[model samples]
Target chain A: MLAGSQNRVQCTEIVLFGVNVAMSWAAVQGWFHKLASPPHFYVTAGRWVPWLGASTVVLLAVGLGWSLFIAPLDQYQGASTRIMYLHVPAAWMSIFVYLVMAGSAAVGLVWRMRLAEVIAASSAPLGAWFTFLALATGSLWGKPMWGTWWVWDARLTSELLLLFLYLGFMALQAAIPDRRAGARASALLALVGVVNIPIIHFSVVWWNTLHQPSSILRLGKPTIHPSILWPLLVMAIAFKLYYMTVVLLRARCALLERERSSAWVQQIVTEQIALCHPLR
Target chain B: MIVDPQTSPRLGRALRTVLVRDLTLALRRRGELANPLVFFVVVVTMFPLGLGPEVDLLARIAPGILWVAALLAALLSLEAMFHPDYQDGSLEQLLLTPHPLAVLVIAKVFAHWLTTGLPLLVLAPLLGVLLQLPESATGVLVISLALGTPTLSFIGAIAVALTVGLRRGGVLLSLLTLPLYVPVLIFGAGAVDSAAGGLSVVAHLSFLATLLILAISLAPWAIAAALRISLE
Candidate 1:
């Protein structure tokens, strides 16, 4: 009898666990459905933008200040190493934003979601800017260390390819006249370009090793000092927040343009017009 | 919806029809068929003139130059891959066929490779000589082009399909496809370079082969999807 009762209790626990999992999954799905709606997303993103923007400014200021002033100079690189804070974050964001864009593109393709498409489109220019920044700063850093403005180093070469990928995405987007078709086409390109990232990285690494063994110095160590690591980490966070702020702002503008004929957008436009033309 | 074997031939038959149709169309436009090959020769010849008649320097960069020219030549031919079909309403008819669109797309790509890429492959050895490529590396250059150019056609088909609906697709097609072509160029040229240096080129050849297999298996589906999106 006691054994039977124990089995019953175990069965009840399993049932409860299953119920909990299902409930949470449903809740997540509900949240996504709500977020997928344009008006809902517009309102939510607008509310979050100022907060994200303010945090970005604060974090970037603190992080850059800490990196430039408080952090000790590298024993080897001296003050020239200061560029790491910007270069590293920009490089990191370049890859991170591509992944995000690709993810949103996949979602947009699979679910036919407009917001995901907008997010993907909006993320490309930002990704390109970050990639360009990384390349520029790396060149600046390379001048002193490698004695040349540019070398076909593995990382830089792959980063250049990444910039091309971004340009291709943007160019595809601009060429198509149909807005939705353009989004879908560029989304497909993004998905295809994602595969090139790893290939570029590996090929560059292999090419670098074969040609120049000791020419380009790697940026950071596996065991970085805490003082330097913390500032770099903080700067990375700041860049991410900045991406969020900018992407959201761009997506909101895109949404306004795309949804101009919808009722909610008309209402918002009327309110703005009323505010602007008080005499009328 | 039952398919009668007598009334409707099998999917294989449908695919063959697509292949034949594309080949026939390509053959009718001899100028279009020969354009990429002509471009390939022109680009290869220009390199010797532009870089001076320094045989040694030309020979050193031969593999890279040939591979890049082949890539650009293939790119030039890709714009016409589906433009006519898309314009003539045949693409919509193909989409509506009972057979799988991917198989039909693959057939079209195969026809494209036969017309454009095969000519480039045949012409590469001649260009190799012009660049003063070592005699021994000529075989590897031919092999690499044969293996790599099909993948280029397959991959370029996706980009061409994506842009086929647009009026100004030429520049966009290059922008979209060039970066993707880098891997093929790397492996293809690397193979010949290794051969020129008397190093083992088995690894590079294997990479090219692997890329070809992957592209052949996957790119048709992507092309089909892109076509659908564009048509819509």
Candidate 2:
């Protein structure tokens, strides 16, 4: 009888495990479907925007302060090295945002998801801004150290090309009158342009070696001191948060514009009107 | 849904029809076909005049100038790739055909290369002489243009397909394509530079060939996808 009970218990345990796996899978699917729905996404993003914005502001302030003041000076670059706190994070985010845009674009194209398109359109300008910041700051840093306003370095040139790509994406999106078509068209351009980033980097590196030989060596290549590295990491996270905040804001605006005729948008507008008039 | 096999052509026949039709249209519009070639010569000519007639200086910069001009000229012709078809509703008809759209796009791009890129390849050596590019490098210059220009047409076709439905797409098309053109420009010009320096041109030529292979294989599907998006 005890042996029989043990076998029954083992069977029940296996059954429970299978049921748990199936339950979690359904839950994940349910969550994905809810997020894909525009109204659900709008609500979820609206709720998170304030927290993301707050964290971005707080983290950026702390990171910048620490980087500029508290971080140890570079043995070679000295105070000029502080520019890296801004440049590196901005550069990282610029590339990261493009990948995100491209990923979202691919998702939108494959699944025909409306929210994915909104995310892509919203991310382009922010990506452009970060890329511009990277170039401008890199130029500023170069002038003092390299003794020139610019050098045709691989990273710098690729960053410049990235800026042009962003402009092209925006131009393509704006030129197409239909919103959905424009989204898909720009998405295709974004995907195609992603291939150039690596080529630009490598070609510029090859060109630099061919032309300049050893004039400009890579700066800050040795292991970074923790004092400096920590703030840089903080700044990178802050920039990511900043991107999230701005993308959410822009996407919310885009969602409203695209879905103005939808029932949920109408309800939101009516609620806003009622809140403002109160007595009417 | 039952139908006679006689009415509909097979995939190969459909692809051939697209190629033949595009070639015939291009031939009929002789002026349009000549525009890019003319633009190439004019642009290449501007550099020597602008920088003064220093033979060595011109020769030093000739490969770059010629390649850049050819790239821009190719771009100028790209707007016409799908604009006429898109306007007259044949692009839609082409999409509706049973043959896959990518095959049709490949045929169209191939015809574009033959019309725009082939002429540029033939005319490059003349520009080489005008720029005083080194005699040894002239062969590599033509070779590079021959290999690289088709890739440009293929890459440029994606941009043109995306913008074909828009009214003011010409300027936007250039903006969209020029960044993507950088690699081809780098490698093509590098091949000539290598040859001029008495180095083996194998590496640069191989790079260009790789780009051509990649562009040919991947760009048609992108162009077809973009065309459908634009049409929708």
For every model shown, the clashing-pair count is 0, 0
Can you tell me which runs of candidate 1 are displaced by over 4 Å?
Answer: A220-222, A274-280
Candidate lDDT (C-alpha), each: 0.92, 0.91
Residue by residue across A93-193, what tens digits does model 1's lDDT show? 99999999999998999899999999999999999999999999999999998899999988899999999999999999999888888889999988888
Q: Ten residues in a row with the worst lDDT in model 1 chain B?
A: B1-10
lDDT per residue as tens, model 2, B90-154: 99999988778998899999998999999887899988999888899989999999999999999
Q: What TM-score would each prediction reach against the true structure? A: 0.97, 0.96
Candidate 2 regions with alpha-carbon error over 4 angstroms = A1-16, B1-4
lDDT of 2 by residue, A141-241 (tens): 99989999998887888899999999999999999888889999999899998876787678778776776776674556677678878999999999999
Clashing pairs in 1: none
Clashing pairs in 2: none
